[model samples]
Target: MSLIYVLDILGTFAFAISGALVASDKKFDLFGVLIIAFVTAVGGGMLRDVLINAHPINWIGDLNYLFVIFTAVVFTFLFKSKIAHLSKTMFLFDTVGISVFTLLGLEKGLSYDLHPIIALIMGMISAVFGGVLRDVLTNKIPLIFQKEIYASACLAGGITYLILNHFHIPENIIFIISASIIIIIRVIAVKFELELPKIKDDLFTKK
Candidate 1:
């Protein structure tokens, strides 16, 4: 199998596990957990595929994607206690998922002849909206709606991919660099409590 395909599967698995953990934290039943896991794993990709008119949505096109997500849910069930003991397990998997998804989405968009700017937007959406859906389902605000620098990091990585591609960098190297840029930006932002500047509430009130 191609490296890119493998990475995509890994990202799906990570996202599924992240969603399953969140559902478990909310005391959701098995059916609820499965729904969240499937959505988190492939919701963004399915949206992207629809927007691009790609026939057969990602998970539908490849049964392996469904298998991976199912395996992830089972893994979470079997090792819930052990996984919970790890520091920031959900955060770690979520970060990895976004980083990988961002690049893959960008490439897919380009393959469909989308303009670079639009492709970058597609990449950001693919990396972020699954989490947004997950949060909305759980009655929490999405991270991107907060000052949290989530979609911004995906855009940064997408830009990095474009620039590197322009310079004729090796595809493997570009993939590694772009994915690392997303992960690094996310990790540093969270560690330092960094955020996009917000408008003061007083400004609106005064107006």
Candidate 2:
């Protein structure tokens, strides 16, 4: 397989594992865990494809995505005990997955001649909406709505990729740099507990 395909599979598996972990935290059963894993793996790609009119979306075109997600669910279940103790490590994995997926999504959007701004938005959605869906289904507020720098990191990566691409940088380099930027940003933010300002309810109170 090509390196791109390998990276894609890795990203998919990472996403699935992250989703499965969340489901486990919520005390979901095997079926629910698998469902979350599958959605987290492909939900963003499906949405991007639909918006770009790239119909017969990616997972539908290739069964390997499903296989990867299932494998991830199984692996996560088997390693649940070990994984539960590694919350920081899991967050790192999740950060990497989101970064890689965001770059892939932006590449796909650019390939379809989408505007750069739209492509950046698509990339953020592709990286994050799956996690949002997973959290919502499990009755938790989505991370994007929380003070975490989640989507912002994805957006920063996406914009960096677009800027680099505009300068005629090679695709491989663009992917690496963009993904690295996201991973670094996420790690630093988590390490320092850095977050955007929370909107205070008092600011919106009627006089």
Candidate 3:
């Protein structure tokens, strides 16, 4: 199997765990947890595929993808209590979730002969849309709207990938560098409580 495929699976697994954690936190039952995990794992990729006209989509034909989601959901649910420790050490599952997906989405776009700008948008969408969907379903403010440098990290990763690609970097190396960039940015943002500036509603308030 190619590294990209592995990264894609990892992204799906991480995202599934993230979703399962959220659902579990919300007191969702097993079925609801599984549903959230599956959708959060595949939703962004599905959107990206549709936009890029990737016929049949990625998970539609692959039973393994479902298997991965199922495994992730089960494991995450079983180990929910212990996962807090994991997050304390490595980047949070949500952060890892976005990092890998951003690279895969950008690569997929490049494979489709898309422009770099569009590819960057695809990367951001692929990284964050699933989380947004999950948050919306759970009645929480989505991370992107909360101004914590979520989607911006994805964008930065995509830009990094494009720059490396422009310099004729190898694919595997490019993936590592770009993915690391996103993860580091997310880690620092969360660690330092960094957030992008929000526009004031007063700007549009009627006098």
Candidate 4:
């Protein structure tokens, strides 16, 4: 498989695991866990496809995606204790997944001749929308809305990918560098508990 394809598969697997982990924490049944895994794995891609008119969607064209998600769910089921205890490890995997997926989304948008701004937005959505849905369904606040450096990291990476591609950098190197930037920023932000400023509830008055 191509490097891009490998990264895509890895990202899907990581996302599936994240979803399964959350579902397990909520005491969801096996079917519910699998549903969360499947949805988290492909939700963003499906949205991107719909918006871009990439009909039939990506998972439809590739059963391997489904296989990967199923495998992730199985792995999570068999090793819930070990995996559940590794919150930092899970975060690391999630960082990698979002970074890689963001680049993939940006590349797809560019390929479709979409504007760069739209491409960047799609990239952010591709990385975080699934997580948002996962959190909402699980009755937790979405990470992106919690002042953490979540979606912003994806946005930074997506924009960096576009800039590098604009300058004609080697595709593989560009992908690696852009993803690294994202992962680094996320790790640093999490490690230091860095958060973006939130709008204070009293900052605005009724007109």
Candidate 5:
């Protein structure tokens, strides 16, 4: 099939594994692990589809998406010990997942004739909200709500993509550039502990 479809599936699988890993860390049972995996795989995309009124949503159309998540869950189960030793590798995979999701989400938004700015937000949401959902389900604060650069990285990538598309860059090249921007941002942020400033809690504290 098309490269976009391939990337989408790859992102789904990556995110599914990420979710399963989180569940494993939390000591969730098998069913709970599977639930978190599926949620993280499609939570963002489903939110985007619903907002944009995409018919039948994404996974509902093919159902093969479910198989992808199932594979991720099984892989996580079989390789739990191995994966535990690959935390850095998993971080890199998470970057790849968000990068692909951001690009695909932006393109999907444009295909629906949405404004570029709105499409950028859509891209950010698609790249981030799944992870947010995963965090929320795990009883942790969402990364985007923290000082993390999670959503910021997606926004930077989306804006670069919009600018490149406006300049008539080749689609393949644009995809590479955009995805690289996202991953680079993520890598730098995580490596350097770069983060947005949090508002001082004393701002509204009672005297």
Candidate 6:
């Protein structure tokens, strides 16, 4: 299989695991856990496809995606205690998922003849919207809306991909470098508690 396809599956798996863990923490039952896992694994890609008018969606046609998500849920259930004990387990899986999803979605948009800028937006959406949906469903704030460097990392990675592609970089190398940029940026941002500046305190005050 192609490296891109493998990365896509891996991202899906990671997202599914993360979702399952969150659902478990929320005391969701089996059905709720499965639903959350499914949404977290494919919600972003589905939104991206619909925005681009891609027919059939992705997981709808590809049973492999479903299989990967199912496997992830099972794995999460089997190792719930052990995985939960690791302080950075969710962070690690989430970082991997977003990094891979950003590049894959960006490349998909480019293949559809989208402008590079629009494709970068698509990349950001694909990387973060799944988590957005998950957080919304779980009654928590979405990370993208928070001050943390979430979608920005995806945008940075997408820009890196575009710049490398402009120079005719090898596809495999570009994928690795671009995804690594997203992962590294996310890691550094979280490690140092870096966040975007908040809105002015008086912006919403009475005139």
TM-score of 6: 0.90
Best by TM-score: 4
lDDT of each: 0.87, 0.85, 0.84, 0.87, 0.88, 0.87
**Candidate 2, residues 1-207: lDDT per residue as tens digits?**
276677678778888998898898888899999999988889988888888899789899999999999988998988888876876766666777788779888878878988889888888878888888888888888878987898888988888898998899988898888889999998898889899877776767887
Top model number, lDDT: 5
Task: Assess candidate 5 and give its TM-score to the true structure.
Answer: 0.91
The superposed Cα distance between candidate 3 and the true structure at residue 177, in angstroms, equals 1.6
How many angstroms is residue 187 displaced in model 2 relative to the true structure, after the best TM-score fit?
Answer: 0.9
- TM-score for each of the candidates: 0.90, 0.89, 0.88, 0.91, 0.91, 0.90
**Per-residue alpha-carbon lDDT of candidate 4 for residues 1-207, written as tens digits (9 for 90 to 100):** 297788788889889999998899899999999888988889898889999998778899899999999999999989888885877777777788899889888888888899999998888878888888888888888867987798778888888898999899989899999999999998898889899887666648575
TM-score of 4: 0.91
* Model 5: pairs clashing at backbone N, Cα or C within 3 Å: none
Better of 4 and 5 by TM-score: 4
lDDT of 1 by residue, 1-207 (tens): 297677778788889988898998999999999999998899898889999998888888999988988899999999988886764866776787898888888888999999999888888878887887999999998867877787778888999999999999998999999989998999999999888877677655965
Sort every candidate by TM-score, greatest first.
Answer: 4, 5, 6, 1, 2, 3
Tell me, what's the RMSD of every candidate?
2.4, 2.7, 2.8, 2.6, 2.7, 2.7
Better candidate number, 4 or 5, judged by lDDT: 5
In angstroms, the error of model 2 at 122 is: 0.8
Looking at model 5, how many pairs of residues clash? 0
What does candidate 5's lDDT look like per residue over 121-158, in tens digits?
88888888888899999999886787668788889999
